[model samples]
Target chain A: MKAWLRFSTSIVNKSVISDIMKLFDIDFNILKADITPRGGKMLVEIDGPQASESISYMEDKGIEVTPILKVVKKDTDKCLECGACVSLCPVEAISILDDWDIDIDNQKCIGCGFCISSCPTQAIALME
Target chain B: MKTIEEINQKIKNGDAVVVTAAEMTLIAKDKDIKTVAEEIDVVTTGTFGAMCSSGVFFNFGHSDPPIKMNKTYLNGVEAYSGLAAVDAYLGATQPNHDLDIGLDYGGAHVIEDLVRGKEINLMTEAYGTDCYPLKKIKAPITLENINQATMVNPRNCYQNYAAATNSTQETLYTYLGTLLPNYGNVTYSSAGELSPLLNDPYFQTIGIGTRIFLCGSAGYIIGEGTQHFTEAERHHGVPITPSGTLMLKGDLKKMDSDFVRGATMPSYGPTLFVGAGIPIPILNEDIALRTSISDEDIGCKIFDYGVPRRTRPVIKETNYQELKSGKIEINGREVPTSPLSSYKRAVKVAEELKKWIQKGEFLLSNPVDLLPNKGQLVKPLNIIKPPKMVCDIERKPVIITHPTDPVKEVAKKLVDNDINHLPVVDKNGKLKGIVTSWDIADAVARGKTKLEEVMTKKVIIAREDEPVDIIARRIDKNDISGLPIIDKDNKVKGMITAEDISRLIGKKNNK
Candidate 1:
């Protein structure tokens, strides 16, 4: 069943990420955060069976993950063309600003906190 | 009148000139030097070995001559001879700066009180001055200065006094060395790399009878750096004997001399001197002996052979990723599967993943639920399908004659390998009788003439349409191992057994 746990890059940092994964024993992939829009939270997606299991695991650690919210994709209209996020991308997930304000490379991004730390204008964040 | 060699020879012979306190008192009174040596042995046997194991010692005193005095003494003459012997032993045992030494407190007191206090008489020189302030000392008071008003001879006079200042004090001694009143702090933790012997894990297992010499770094690690007539002074300096500068005899002499090579000589100050006969080899082997230098043969041989460095054990970690993957071949094509996959085929991949996670083949952040993803459950073999009927083998009949019987007879009369029972019938075939292996057994047990009488009877059976649970219940209630499979026409078709039921539930007799 291709089941994987997901995490938001906002709260957890890369330093403690490996330790947390080892501690929980969960298999997951990281998805980059899209923070340009105002309301954005951590996004974790899984199939029905694994989704329930992941939620319970998070709950056990007192991390409430109920009433799940939909992942909010970034809008193309808010193009500032600042090109500030390109350098901040740890996994090189953010593309060069040309015709578009910002383009995301989903494959390279590990959904970590690099872009969050680099965002001077606080424009980028993970959407859930 | 005796030379240093002659004195050393006397001490080696175990004879020391002892000058007692009373004799010293008389010498102070008479002011004589000639009769003192004659009255006491040149080297006293009583001071053969040093008193304490280790600590700093000081000597600042002088002694009276023996010409005017006729009696012996223990005051200063005995200790000086002891000091000389100690230095000899230290020079012999640890020629290198390898040995930790004990200090002579008596020597320090004598030097400070007798030599500096009486001979030099600093108090007398500064008596008329009011500029010098009164100083209070917090150490043990062993000796007090008194009665120095007599007109003194050259030997007893303060002019011949030499002061070993704080800097000079550390270097003049070796084994029984001591630091000045305040010479930095003391370290109580492991020193250096903490020699291998003390750090060896198997050290405790060594038996008491083993003559382990605590030598080299091992000696210093275990030894508290205490030796009689020796002190461990933290300061650095050159080694100077009473007669000559041991460290400054030129390159050829220095290269050949082991004693002066490693000796720490203070350039600006005196280093600590330890003068004990305990060698490094002795210290390495006999931990008990090294600690107790007070033992009779503290300087004697502690080990007949030298000890070699011990090797440390190595540890390695193991990997079992291959066995855990459980890769199997399907039509010569390799596919990885978990051992638990065979138990539940629908979630084979999920089971494999779970097994890998458990074996640490892959890291897992949390527990996961198995996903179906259109996975199909493996079906059981058709031969062992659920029972469609319940029949008692003992109740069914075996018909020997008649083919034109009813359809029930026709159905039960078949000579099939799967069917072991049959219903007997007359011309009408109106449920006349049944036959089975048990019927024949009963015929034999009852000593019946033939199977005909025993086989004539009623059949205990259920319809084929009955649920498997109901059929199992009937078999359990009847206490029979097998039953007949009957259709709605009241005719037998097949048979069932406990073995078949057991085979369906994943049970195997071989396993």
Candidate 2:
């Protein structure tokens, strides 16, 4: 199961993921991480029989967790490919092709929803 | 030097060579302008950006009952239906007023849907008359069913524009995209090198009746755009303060959905993304030089959005090269920059236009009327004191309220007097604070009953004898609709509003 975890500034220094791994017997792999003193966000894939239990434990420990059940989808019918969403992506997931078409990498996208709000055409949506 | 007619004849005969303005830059760097002019018959220029002033006019075929649409909405977004019985104009910026997701849908979306050959839900209402018996009509309409759908814009491509940055701590969401707080990023919106007006800076080749590439179809320039300031300071024939603009006309049926898109700013509502291209005939050396202008030569000032004024202070004057570099130095800080306009699309448009000319599918037309060289000076409205009118203190007593007054009573007094503002004063007639209708409404919503709790303690006041111009400027600068006029003793005398200033201006104009 893939999930996105948000860590507040105070809890950012804690080894919550290691604690979860030891207590729940789940193998966790960090996909992407953007941690700063202000706050931090991490996209991780937790694989185990107790993945759901580990996620619940993380949320109970004051860590915000959202399951990665959806991927960013671009509607070719409505998208203008203006690249307005290219700069808003925190993970360089949205990029402009050689022909000027805006491409979104589903694998790189963390489903942050930042590009969805900034899109003027409302062409990009997080689809389950 | 070859005339424009000769260049057009060569293009018509497929004997002329054409290159994009961006390509012309590289060609001219190696050769002289005269040589480039003689070699290239046409230089293509383009701009792809959010054009909010764009709209489409539709002549909906009459229904069986022949209904006259006075009010119309396409997918809950309002369309202007005041032209004729069946004719309507849908502006790109019209919000979906009645829908909860109104901001997400607008006239631009309707046009895009139409261009994609999709049926649109149209709802219209009209008063039944003797000739037209229908009162209301709701149906699905498509481009094929409509008689005529023309896109007429008051302003299309601006020659140049200012860069916007935020110096405040809070993020600012504006037409320039999101401006990060503390000068974190800057955003600009011009196509720079590929822009039409930038290539033909003096309106040399582009004017009324000139054909252009509009949203993947051919369109024509109708007239000068609104606020076309041709007399601004110029460098290499391009004005820094958006000197020239174009009024364009095109057929909606011929436009492609790929070039024309619907866009919604979070709080600013909807706008249309327009992709346009124009071909400049290289008739002379000067025209070739103008088209060959590079990004290094085109510069725009960076304005601080924190100032909150029409005349924002210029922090730096940087060229498009620095602007496109993704980071620029502002006040010793290297701030990230973003462009609202798509340069990639703009280049694609220019290249496509060049291909059209090279294939002899497109030709150039001479201007029916050239734009004015000198722009009329915008005069500020002066504060003219009428001989019969006296100072603010000599006027009728202003409506006042006490701090001890109940919120309900203050609200009632405001409604009864049809006034939105009231100055709170003491028993000795000294001003204490002020209350507005917003305060009363907020108090009512919050279930507050005391006037003191709802009123603003720091009141903005104006002197009785102060010049109306200064007061009006102050009101405008502060974004306040009105201010309370006070005497020397800090007593409330009267009030002045934006309406009063407008009325004074109207009276002066009448005189």
Candidate 3:
């Protein structure tokens, strides 16, 4: 199971992540993280029986935790299909179709959210 | 050879052999231009891309009390209200006045919304006059309520455009979409052979009043577009760079949202993605020859947009064939290429136009005036360097003042020396500030007695040996009529006024 974690300024520097990692014998992998001294967000994949409990532990540490539901969604109405996000997509998940409209393959997408940010019209949304 | 009228007659008769520019390319592969010209009546073309130089002018019928509106805004995005009362021009790229919400919604969205029959927040301000007394208005307006909604794009239908790539270490966001750093990506926007101006490379058939497809609706070519490049060198008949632009006009009410969309570039702001196309009337073999030109034959310079300036270095010259192939090489490194302009949509537009012509719904008009010949020099806006220095032009006595001095004393000194400008100096004769005749008049009008109260405190001073041109520009830009000339120690040595610069021009011209 994948989980989204937000580190607020108060608990941002805490070593509770390492504490949870030690407490749980789960397959843990940090997928993406953007951090500053103030605060930031991170996406992680944690598998095994203690995944849910480890999330609860991080929640108690004041790190906002939410289960990763899906990778990204493209709002077709807002997309101009200009292909501004195609070259910037590292996974080659976003592509232009024969009709010149954009197509996003969630299976190929690593949930990096680069397409969501590179989109000119803010057409892509990360699924909560 | 068939004339435009003959093509129109055939179009109305439902027997015109009209095909798309894309189809024409494939047909021309087997047949020659002369044979194609003899058979085809018209070759339709299309392009859908971000046209930043696009806007709609609205003429809202007068309100109950009527207002000579000088400032107008639609959905918080300001419009150019310089025209008659209640009429305003909303540019496509004009961002919202409310910076927070406006980053997404702007003039382009307003136009798209208006076309979608969505109600807009129409706001206006006026200085109440006798005949037109309404001071302000804030109301909801729809396309149905406005008297006129016309899209008048000053520039569109680029003949061709250079592809853009970045050589820098960081990603670059430009009109050519997002360019990856270190030549990681290349982006181009023209629709190659399908481009309207490219098919009519010499503009033999397209001209003023030539009918066209604008936003999925009928429009007309107005004239030469702004920054219309007449001087670009050509390969065969097509330009190697961005050239020939069209001034376009159409009824906004007839436009479809599918063809006219409001889009925003992540960090680059808003632009209107307009779907446009034009039909080339096969009047002669030349027309057929131009239309037969294909993507592979067209070449475009790839410019390094990494250097942000008026002119960027050309990376290499490549053609649309390689560009559409999805990759190209820069500095011997493989770089992916993307088209910000959708060729699929361009083909769709061309098909739509072709269907319209085949169905006898649209007819071609003979150009009232053809587009002008090419080879107008692409001139840069060069800032001329004037060859005279302040000390070289001649000198005048330094008009000095003290900070604590009274306004009357400065007025007396100005009147005695027949000067209107005075540079305020300190006890050690260092330049402190400046005061003008206008300052004294302002002092009396505001009832100020102290010179410092009326004098400009943060003075703009120039050096004696500096170019008079630089000092003259400084004075003009600062909105001050004069500037104090000081020495290395900051002591006021002299003063140069607008009048002095005017005199220097006369002297230089005479010499």
Candidate 4:
């Protein structure tokens, strides 16, 4: 299970991850972290039996945890297949196929939200 | 050479071998051009790109008492109502008065909404006249009410376009779309090989009255489009820059929202993304050869859009094959590339057009007149001012020198007058040659004392009536500091040096 965890500016300076490591029986891996003194979000993979318990614990500790079923979703009906998002993917997750249809590899998508903004039709949306 | 009528006859009989521009490229590579020419009858091409110079003219008929509407607004977007009482032209790029710059609703949106069968508010204001008594009117209108909703796009279907990238530190929002800073990404708008104009590069078959698939409906090439510059640099019969465009006209009421889209280019206001295609009749081997040129052969110049100027400098030239590969090397950095034009829609347009022709539902029309290949030039809009002639600029009197004068005397005159050029005249006072300081030094160094030996006989002279700009160009072209201004009789009129022009400019600046 993957989830996006956000910390409030007040709790940003605290070592909440360390607390979770000692408190929860769950195993986790931080997929990506973009944090600042002002506080930001971190995408993490939490696939232990106590993943839900861990998420609830983070919420209780003044952290917002959103379960990530998918990093980005595309409404195929609205996609114009203009290739506006093909190269914006730093990890080469999105591409235009031979038939000119957009193919998104969520495995490679780091949830940068570049494709979401680059799309002219606003078809691609960040999924939480 | 196969005649257009012959191709039409085949099309009518459902026996014409037709293919899309994309298909033609495959066949072209496998078979010889001559074989391809003999095998193919017509090649259909398409492009779904943002064409800014698009609009529609509507005649809303006479209002209640038929008010002479001098101003008209459709859903808050201003439409040009400078024509007759009820006729107005709504441009695609016109921004909505009420909306912000980003994704702002405009006339293009109105057009799309109308095509989608959505009702739009129509408002107008005018001074009451005897013929038209009503002063103001506001009404919700749909595609049903308008008597004439003709889309007369002055320009569409660009032959080729520049790929833009930003080399500056900050991002740039351009008509090409948003270019990330430091050559972050490249955006190109042309469909390359699938583009109609690239298929018929010379506009031999595509001309006035040529039938086309414009925005999902039948359209015609009314005339050569605005900024139809055919003189752009070519690579394999296709332009490497913004060249050859089409002035298309079609029924806006019949167009589909899928093909006729209202697009907002990031922060750069509104523009219509039109889908258009032209079926080229392979009347000759040359046409077949041209239509088959692949994307690898068609090149697009990448320009740095960081500089806010009309003429952006080209950073590098790369073909569509490289551009489509998603990465290109520029300044030793591998920058990613993207396309603003929908190639999928372009293919769909070509496929749709091919289906129409194959089913005998659509027939190709012979152009009444061909597009102009000459005399059409894009005259830049610049500050209007009169030309200043060489005579207008203050210059020194002609320092006369006879051909019989000694080299030492010529050098003395040059040194005393603080002048570099002294025109050497013959016995008849007609200008023969000119001696410069460099020439004097060369004469002394070469131990040649004759005035004829020192003086350059092949003198490049400037005419008094010549425009200052022309003289300046001549000076730069010749790589000289000065020139002797001469009259019709070849007599030295005056001497205009680069220094004199600079001095005059300096004094003018002081004032």
lDDT of every model, 2 decimals: 0.28, 0.82, 0.85, 0.86
What are the per-residue Cα lDDT tens digits for candidate 4 across B9-95? 888899999899999999988888998999998899999988889999999887667888888999989999999999999999898
Q: Candidate 4: give the clashing pairs.
A: none
- Per-model TM-score on C-alpha atoms: 0.15, 0.72, 0.74, 0.76
**Residue B351 accuracy (lDDT) in model 4:** 95
Look at candidate 2 and tell me the lDDT of residue A24: 90
lDDT of 2 at B98: 72
| Model 4, docking class | acceptable
Instruction: List ranges where model 4 is wrong by over 4 Å.
Output: A6-15, A22-53, A59-64, B99-103, B384-511
Instruction: State how far residue A57 of model 1 sits from its true place (Å).
Output: 88
TM-score, candidate 2, is 0.72
Q: Which ten residues in a row have the lowest lDDT in candidate 3 chain A?
A: A106-115
Per DockQ, the best of the predicted structures is: 4
Q: Label model 1 with its docking quality class.
A: incorrect
Ranking by TM-score: 4, 3, 2, 1
Q: Write out fnat for all predictions, comma-separated.
A: 0.00, 0.35, 0.60, 0.67
Point out the worst 10-residue segment of candidate 3 chain B by lDDT: B373-382
Q: Against the true structure, whose lDDT is highest?
A: 4
Model 4 misses residue B441 by how many Å? 62
Q: Write the per-residue lDDT of candidate 4 for residues A1-128, one digit (tens) a residue.
A: 77899988999998888888888888898878889999998998887777788788889889999887788899987777888778678888888887888899877777878777666666889876
Q: After superposition, how far is residue B443 of candidate 3 from its true place, in Å?
A: 56
Count of backbone collisions within predicted model 4: 0
